[model samples]
Target: LVNGVLVAYGGMVPFIATLAMLASARGLALQITDGKTQIVTVPSVLDLGLPDAYVLGIPPLVLVFAAVTVAGWLLLNRTTFGRRTIAVGGNPEAARLAGIDVRRQRLFLYLLSGLCCGIAAFLLIVLAGSGQNTNGNLYELDAIAAAIIGGTLLSGGRGTIVGSVLGVLVFTTITNIFALNNLQSDVQQIAKGAIIVAAVLLQRRTVRDGT
Candidate 1:
């Protein structure tokens, strides 16, 4: 849809379109919540069904994260759709010339991303017991930083699930270390920005060296 039309007619990059949508969605959510944080109390039955407690000596959330990581690895490494997605991201024109439906693949990728976001939101709400327009503010930066640090090319076509997981671990470790030191949010933001810049520079150097 909307993304297709924006790219076709408006000559907008898909990321820009998505960023616009994110802003709009956040605005709408704020209006719905009357600029107040909305608390969500899960019903006991639903809570019971969900992983509220530890399982197999691991926190349920940790288990869920592991499951998602494994599933992502399998999808990206073992599926035709994943191959097509990489192809499209790497070079859309070439992908189309190779008889791949580039538009369809892009659509599927966006759908998959949205599904992941939905799942993350569900997990966050469950963990926090609340929902707010600001719940994920600036999280896009964290995600991009993690991916790039993990060797996921911002230009696309190259990435590994394991690397991404490692990147997340790196980011988590940094955050925890900062928290332990009682650092300010400003310091955290500065560190994140620095990491993103460093990762991008490293990526450029690697690409230049053809590594």
Candidate 2:
């Protein structure tokens, strides 16, 4: 429905449209919860007993993350859909010329993204035993930062799941270090902004040199 409205209206790009939707969603959540956090009780199977369960002395969440990383890598590198995605990202006009249905592909991708978000939300709620309007505030920024740091082209075309995983680790490490040092949130934001700028500049340089 959001996509239909955005496409029909034909002004905002997907990112901007999504941002507006996010704001509305957050507002609705706040209204539903009366600005209070919602506590959730999950079945044991869904929880995976992260507080007690460990395999090879590794936390369940770490194992789950590793599994997801491997699955993402396989999907992106070993599937025809993945190849088409890369082609579309590299040059949508060329992809269309080559018989790829760019719109359909994008719609499928969006559905996949929603599925991932649903899964993430489930896991998050299970982990925290709660849900709130503020649950994923600023997560989009974190994801963009990670993708940039992971060598994903801002202009779109190239990326690696492995690189993204490493990028996430780097961000996580930095956040942990900051917390340990008792640094201010402002400093953390500054650091992240600097990293994003550097990544973008590096990508531009690479593109220029390639040309």
Best by TM-score: 1
Stretches of candidate 1 above 4 Å error?
1-11, 45-52
Which model scores highest in lDDT? Answer: 1
For candidate 1, the 10 contiguous residues with the lowest summed lDDT are 44-53
The deviation in Å at residue 111 for candidate 2 is 1.4
> Scored by CA lDDT, what does every candidate get?
0.83, 0.80
In angstroms, give how far residue 203 of model 2 lies from its true place. 1.3
Error of 1 at 95 (Å): 0.8
Q: What tens digits encode model 1's per-residue C-alpha lDDT throughout 60-169?
A: 66777898899998999899987987898899899999999877777667677778887888778777777888888988998998898899998988999999999999
lDDT at 36, model 1: 87
lDDT of 2 at 4: 31
Candidate 2 structure, TM-score to reference: 0.89
